[model samples]
Target: MAIIETRKLTKSYGSIQAVRGVDLSIEKGEIFGLLGPNGAGKTTTIGMLCTIIRPTSGSASIAGYDIVQRPSAVRSKVGIVFQDPTLDTILTGYENLELHARLYGITSALRKKRISEMLQLVDLTDRRNDLTRTYSGGMRRRLEMARGLLHRPAALFLDEPTLGLDPQTRARIWDYIRKMARKEQTTVILTTHYMEEADQVCDRVGIIDHGQIIALNAPGNLKESMGGDLVIIRTKEPPLVKIKALPYVREVKFNDGVLEITMKDAHLHLSGLLFMIPGVECVEIRVPTLSDVFIKLTGHDIRDDSAEDSGSWIDSVARYRQKGK
Candidate 1:
């Protein structure tokens, strides 16, 4: 049976539809990824399923209990790690876990054993008594992870779990998640902006764009279904209509001055495509990837909006609308 199931799940905030009709089925012992840009509804979807937010329309179930009709049961079956840290820094790690166990109504007899196992799983057994504020960013994340799993929920929800950690720390946390998921036979729902993380950790990913899933499949399968290698070119000005007319090209998109196209047997089409397009300065041909799949589906990269890349979005929107006209 599916550990989590949704049918046309949706959420709206006043004038904005944060999540549209979304259907998902996550099996037991599977690591599923919900990947998208900042406001593409990844968190809203997770929030609704976790019973933290009610869907404006549609239905969902966690661990076979309806989210709307049986919220308490759904909550009991799921554990969540939010993007921001929610731990009390003043308290010791052990104290936090103890509190979580008490709040969850974990039996007193099982509380101690469960907390110890969680701390060990996150590699915090030795420092379980230290004040959380004394811990490093990675350590604190690990502690939060441990607390989330303290009750041994059937489903684990991680919202950008390693957002601010260093590379080494992020990798370590991923290892712990994988280890715990396998050991506990838990279903994990991960939402992350990091492409490499989703590519590496998830058993399958649902690519959400503008509040709906545009693609869903295993990472490798998604890449393979993109239909052939990518042939990229840098040109002064891409003739969109002319390029679209090129035979053997499955898809063509011109973003900025970079022209990206997919073709069956890219090696066979690369030289011909480069020669046919005018003002070519550089050329590249490579295998498709998850990032490529996302760009193909959404027409934009999944990047943090705090960076320089954020400013270009206005111009992109303008161009997109003008093209629509």
Candidate 2:
């Protein structure tokens, strides 16, 4: 059954259309990724689905509840983790979860049991009594996740859950998310700009750009859609001007003395490339990654400043809240 579904969903802020005619369906217990560049309407979509923001046009449902007509029902089944931390600094990790349980109207007896289980699930049982202000970034993230799960929500919405954490912490959180999904059989809808995160954790990804979904498929399938292996060659001189003219190469792009070539057969063309361009410093042949696919489809780098800037204001707000506490 479809746990979440949308038809021509849209949201606008005066003259700016943040989301436009988006259609989506996510199955129960599936990990669905909303992948896109900044300003692509990913967060807006999540906000609408979670009933935090109303759509300007179109319709959506969460776990069989219409977002417009049955918002309380939809909200009851959905748990949201914003891109930034939402925990209270003065509250201990356990206290924060307890507060969430209360908000969800969980009974006192069940709340204690659920809190204990959630803390263990996130591997934070050892420090449950510590104030959130004293917790590490990863710990706080886990605590927030636990709080979201306190009510045993059927669908979880995580927006950039590991955005600014170090790589090690990010990996750890990824494992936690996967484990939670499997053990709880909860449908997960995550929005992120991180290519690796989507490739590694999502069952399928929907690529959004300019407030529209440009592509949707499994990570491997999406990469395959670009067609062929990728060969990255670095040299001291420009080669794209010549490489683009090669017989078998489909496309050639060069930036900062690095050439990216997309070809149907890398093995057949690699030797020819080397022979054609002498004194090449480095030649790297690899399968097309999510990043490569993103670039090919979008004609822009995935991690550019514009993408980073879209969420910087939220980050700044989070920092200010942290300082005030």
Candidate 3:
């Protein structure tokens, strides 16, 4: 049975539909990733599935319990780590986990055992007694993960879990998450805007855009779907002229002075491309990546939003219409 299921789930605030119809099914013991650009409804979907907000329509189930009908049961089976640190800065890591355990109604004895296990899981057993305020960003993130798992939840929800951590720290957290899934057989659903993170960690990924899922599949399958290798060309001249003329090129686009080429066989065409286009300074080739797939599908970089406005749904809608939606 699917550990988490959503059928046409949606959320709206007044007239603005924050989340459009979204359907997803996550199996047990799998790490599923929800990926999208900012304001693309990834958080809204997580909010609904986590029962932090009611969906405007449709339904969701967690661990066989309906989110709307059996909220308590569903909550009991799921743990969440939010994008922002939710830890109490003044409290020690152990204290925070203990408090979380109490909130979840974990037995006192089990709580103690779980806290110890969790601290060790995140490699924070030595720092368990230190106040969270004294911890580094990476340390606090690990502590938060430990606290979330204190109740032995069957499913874990991580919203941008490694957002601000350094690369090494992020890698360490990824190891812990993978280990937890293997050892505990826990199903994890993580939301991230980082394509590399999703590609590297998730067993399967759903690419969301404009409040809808644009693509969904295993990372390798999704990359394979793009068909063939990717060749990135850097040159002093504008790429449009050369890119349009290149043979065997499936698609070509230029952004920020970098030329991206998608081809069926990058190796077969590299020599030809170099010979054809002058002023080519550098060439890089690799298998299709999640970032490459995202760009190919969306025609825009995930992190390249220059819009200068922030407000509630009502304001966004009005602005969107005024600017011609």
Candidate 4:
């Protein structure tokens, strides 16, 4: 069953359309990744579903509650970890979870039990009493994850969960995420810049660009869609015409003096390709990655895009909470 569903969901900011006519049905307990370059509507779509930003057209529901009509219920069913940190530095990790539990109206006994389990789950039990101001970035992120899951929400939304973490820390975070999903059967909807991490953790990913989802599928399937082996050749002068004429060649793209060609059986054709294309300084044959898929579909590296257009929505959340106060 779909715990999250949307139809023609859209959010327009005056003359600028942030998210346009997005349709999605995410199954229960599924780990879904929303992949896109900056300003591609990934965050906007997430904001709408999380009820942080209202859609201008269409509708959506989370855990069977209408986002617009029953926003309180929707909020109760989902947990969110924004791209920007929102933790209170003055409070200890334990205090943070305690505050959230109280806000959710969790009974005293249940709240204590839940906080204990979450602290251990995130491996922060030892430092739970320490002020959050002293916590390391990775430790803080794990604490955020634990806090988000404290209420046992039906779904969790994470935006750039491991943006600045080291590789080992990132791996540990993903492990915690998987364990939580399996133990609680909670659906995870996250937006991330790390393609490899998404490919590893997500069961399916949606690639959005220009306020629309251009592709949605499992990582493997999406990468497979890029056709056969990817042969990247660094050449000032590429033999584009001859390469295109090859019957086995799937596609060819040249940018910044590098040729990215997808073809069948690269080992069989690399020698011939090298012979045909002059000034071939380098040759690399590898499988297609999520980054490659993004470049192929969007014509730009996901990292190359500027994030300025993707203004921070966490501030909006702060403002919303201020109103509630």
lDDT tens digits, residue span 168-278, model 1: 999998998899899888899999877778899999999987789889899988988879888889887877787788777889888889888888777677777777778
Query: Candidate 1: misplaced stretches above 4 Å?
Result: 230-285, 300-325
Per-candidate alpha-carbon RMSD to the true structure: 6.9, 8.0, 6.5, 8.9
The residue-by-residue lDDT of candidate 4 on 40-155, one tens digit each, is: 78889989998999999999998899999999999888899988888999999999999999998899989999999999988999999999999999999999988889999999
Q: For candidate 2, give the lDDT of residue 228.
A: 79
TM-scores for candidates 1 onward, in order: 0.78, 0.79, 0.78, 0.78
List, residue by residue over 1-325, the lDDT tens digit for candidate 2.
9999999999999998999999999999999999877667999999999999999999999889999999998888989999988899999999999989998889998988999999999998999898899999999998888888778888999999999999999999999999999988899999988888889999999988778888889997987777778898887675556878877788888788888888877977688788777668988998877866766665442234334444433334333544565
**Residues 146-241, model 3: lDDT tens digits:** 777778788889999889888998888888889887877788899987788789899999988778888999998888887778788887675477
What TM-score does model 1 achieve against the real structure?
0.78
Give the winner by lDDT: 4
> Candidate 2's error at 63, in angstroms?
0.4
RMSD of 2: 8.0
Off by over 4 Å in 2: 231-283, 300-325
Report how far off residue 307 is in candidate 4 (Å): 19
In angstroms, the error of model 3 at 156 is 0.4
Instruction: Give every collision pair in model 3.
Output: none
Error of 2 at 222 (Å): 0.3
